[model samples]
Target: MKKIVWLSLVVMVLLVLAACGGGESASAPKESDGSASGDTASTETFTYASTSDVVGMSPILTNDSVSANITEHVYEKLFERNIETMEFEPQLAESYEIKDDNTWVIKLKEGIKFHDGTPFNAEAVKYTFDKLRDPATAAPRASLLEPVDTITVIDENTVEIKTKYPYGAFLASLSHSNAAIVSPTADQAQDLMKEPVGTGPFKFVSWTSGDQVELEANEEYWDGAPDLKKVVLKVVPEISTAISMLQAGEIQFIDNLPTEQIKRLEAMENINIEKKEGTPVYYLTFNHSREMNQDPEFREAVAAAIDRDAFVTKLNGLGVRSDSVVGPQVFGYDESADEAGTAYDVEAAKALVEKNGYGDKPIKLLTANRDNFILMAEIVQAQLTEAGFKVEIESMEWATFLDTARGGEYDITFLSWSNVTGDGSELLYPNFHSDNVGSSNRAQYSNPEFDELVVQSRTTIDQEERKAILDKANKVMIEDNAVVVMYHGIVTAAMDKAYSGLELDPNGKWTLKNVTGE
Candidate 1:
């Protein structure tokens, strides 16, 4: 009976994968004759597999990479970052200037409209900023604008911003997806979390929960319509199934390419692989809200028990061993400070566990059931058990795991954060600040001095001064065992030979602005 149930479950997963797979059944633009058109810029429907499901489409609420990637195509920020030049280019705003140490004035681009036909003007920008600043909205990225005092509209196209203090990363932070401008109605509607209304190249079509989110190009876009008429972000959490779908021409791209399958995939005639240095930090966080994980000695025991070299090797070299919580790709990464944080020493870990009397209960390690995460958890479990600590692994779907971790339901959880803004302020403030306890600070870890340092980094205009302040704060967090620093990853993606011009930004965001199909 157990075998029958297992086989039935396997069959169900396969059926779902087959239904979600690519082929002629994929959504495409209809010709004048009401028939499916051939692969071209206008008719090709590109289906791409994602490793995790999107939490929600509301740009201000989600902090995950997958949601950011999807929302970016449907929403527009005031400014956009140029990957090649590393400069900010105007998107919704035509020009912006700093009037004083506490004031910024922005001129919005005229004649722009949301997909819902709402005018994109100074009022729209003000609405978005007001929503972000309101604590009732509970925006996860609200801390990005903690210094802003108020936003005032000077005219139809001009908006003035006054800050409580001098903010160094204010303009750069606006480029983040969380700062995406939305239609006034959409921002206030209950359905906005699921149905996004924005001014971008694509408009939200439909989202099949846990399966896929479909988007159609906005033909009336200010920057011109996208080349691909329809795009589907399919949730295929299994790497093996995604590869199979890619080969079968059911899916056009694979975002979570398995490192072990890279050699085999490269040998395929139709597959092209692209790689870039990732700005994400994959690490373990202890829920300081819970008593079991609150002890500094316990966190150190957990950190020292594992071998970083083995962990990297086990992932088939998909990432480099990260000594710092912040990746080297992000600013304010001090090598010497990170080196002094933690190291593998089984004897010391066991000694700490014994000294702290921490082996009385089992530590629940929560993680998503991804291939790499499970492997890492198993290795860590073995090491922790060897160090005389009771350990148990609890696995769930990616979305559920995220929800559980955010609710502080786990003792420890394996997670990764992508610093998409490429700024040191972004790296430190959200995850370490006490104000972010229920949001990005999954650890629920708080320290008064650490919080002050993070604020100091944001208030200063000098980059060197900000870096120095963060360096000291980072070292303090390490000493406190706020979280376990693991490794930095590399972004690996594979697409069919038919696709072109897909660019992966250094912050690990794939922009579809220039992607085209032949």
Candidate 2:
């Protein structure tokens, strides 16, 4: 039954791709009245193209990149990273303090109000978190606030969070757009995606499902009215189409431009290209709970057979080879962690397989039908077969692949980890911790000592102390053959020269709150 659904979704996705030309430009919407004009900085509407439509606005249901991108424009987090320095700064909150091991005392910034005119105060903070923590909501991001046991309002402008354990990354986590605070008066039970009200510089205006979304600048924004009056997010699922649209002047910006097309687009007179080192690690996972692939010997052999440099060069032309699950852009990635366990030694791989006495069992490799992943998986299959293991390949749609991978159904699967907090803890706990088994731990690999280290790192507020713990955990993970760290992806964006103030977050997001036109 699962296989049928997977095949059907693949067929539908292909049909959609076929119906639209892969490289043709899309037409832009007609300019709306009161849109931003070039003559003045105020009142401008910018049309932007993205490769996919947001799955939904509900932060709990899905963490789709497209949805998060659009939501960032309409929501405001308590803290945000400074564009120039990439450092955390207060936004909704004026300041905060770690008064004790498990307490975070926060002071709300005055004169700031939600788009709906509700006061942004301590009560609002408590209400927002309470809704997110409610089990009925099933918010996908609820895990982000797992440390907080309760939020207490000390006064109208003051609040305190008492956590079950000490967490140094709490403030960094708040900087994520997923942690955006919403108004308590805006229907606690409302469909957040369809109707979102926050203290952002822009307010949700309209959404044409699978087509476009519009936003209007908040004139009463505490910082000041946004320079642009309106913004339009156009969903164009094909990367080629997005680039073409930008070239034709129909769209002013195209996010996530494919590396292959970047060279061609660079020659265009009206486009501007921006490149940033991203913290996304694209790697393959082995189902350690499965009988055939779970053997440490077989896993290590497979890891040794594949060439990391080749994968990066062929599968991802613009990415850096990853030595750890945490990318170089992450805060605590140890430069000299471990490099002794695995190398592209096919002979060594074969010797290990023979030593394990797994004569010639065929291993199944799974990946989404996406272009790059399919190519990567096929290459891996070829490499493993050469090293004395029979291999079978399976391809499915992205959503189905995610479900099956999480279920531990595949012997091997292609996956990417987008660290939400830009911290080592985000990588350590989700994919390696025993408690996260059958969820983020698709590998089902566990080590009691490694788990303890992760837990200790999370509650340890000292930077150097947490780093030492995480470094040890990373070393354990690599030596155990838990999962192979492939490459850290480089994020690339192509925008019209007319658009400015576009910035990339460490999490591979492009924020447009301060974007302006020439």
Candidate 3:
């Protein structure tokens, strides 16, 4: 019966994956046929799949995962990323120079205009920054640019930004979607969720709420016009529904294609699958605020009890078991620390539990009420039980679970963090820093030394020095039982052979502005 349940789950996952796989289907424009002439003639329309609806269109409040994928096409940032190298490249800003350690002089590209016909200039840039810093706006990503002390309009096309302290990652942070510039005349009174205006290769046309969002090619774009005229983002959460849409000519591209469906799609001559190593890390976090977990020996015991190799092999076949919160893809990540080993040892876990007088304590595991998370919770529960710990599972909705976890209401919980930038500093500040406790630090773990190391790492310009600090900080976090690191996520995308030019940024965002269809 146990085998049957596992088999059933596997079969269901495969079926969902197969439905999400790509196929040659009829190409019909969803909305706004590109009859605009000029460069927009080559490509007519494109369709993409998303699992969830965008939370909001305002860059400040848009925290939903799907919003980045959709808004990226309709907005442009100061700096873009080089797809191959993952380095910062010029976009709205043609070039920038560091006048001093804490000051950046940025030169904006001339003659660039927003979709509302407002000329893009230094004043426009300053206005955007002012809006971001506005207390009333309450931008979610304000922290990313908190170092900026002031924005000075040096000239028509030049702006100078002074930071409170030297920040080595400012340029890279500009590549974030939240940094995307909007029109100066953008309706500050009207919620951007209803109407979004930006200066990108695509223009927002309409959003059908749960069904689809439509965009039209921006013919007056400063950069060359996008080849595709109309782009439609279909919200289909079920993987099977996405695959069926691809196969039945309802859509052209699907993101997050399940791994099990790869074989079936590969067999289909008309379908194409593009797989890229993803940067999302899925892991379990322990609520260290609880008395039972506050004991170092108890925490160590729990860490040693779970077999990471088994989880990686059985639960995440396409991912690597992470020994630390930082993933291998992140720049400055230390593989040596991972190689030192933290694999499961039943005897060691039992010994630690006995040494800490926590042998008979009941352990509670908390997780969001998602199918994948439930599976993971069940696996952890079984593993810890075998190691002599009494385990209980609690499930809640994603939002409730997040709030509860942040409030330190659980002993252990299945959680994941998507790295904003491909930087280790991003991982440390939000998860391990003492200041982030009761906020981003859901574990409620705190250490003054760990906090100091994090601050030092951020201000240090020397790469080696920064790395040493991060390495030490990570070790400290592990020793403190801040959280048990699990596996990094893998992104599998399925698209029809005709679709082209969809590029994945190093930050793991799909840019569809320049995407075209043959």
Top lDDT model = 1
Question: Cα deviation in Å at residue 45, candidate 2?
Answer: 3.7
Question: Candidate 2: where is the Cα deviation over 4 Å?
Answer: 1-44, 83-86, 187-189, 315-317, 338-341, 351-364, 369-371, 388-400, 438-442
TM-score of each: 0.90, 0.84, 0.83
Q: TM-score winner among the candidates?
A: 1
What does candidate 3's lDDT look like per residue over 187-280, in tens digits? 5546667678888888888999878888899998887888888888887767667776676455677765554555655554444666666667
Off by over 4 Å in 1: 1-43
Q: Higher-lDDT candidate among 2 and 3?
A: 2
Deviation in Å, model 3, residue 46 alpha carbon: 2.5
lDDT of 1 by residue, 226-257 (tens): 88889999998778888877766667787656
- The C-alpha RMSD in Å for every predicted model, in order, reads 10.2, 12.5, 11.9
Clashes of 2: 7
Model 3 poorest ten-residue lDDT run: 33-42
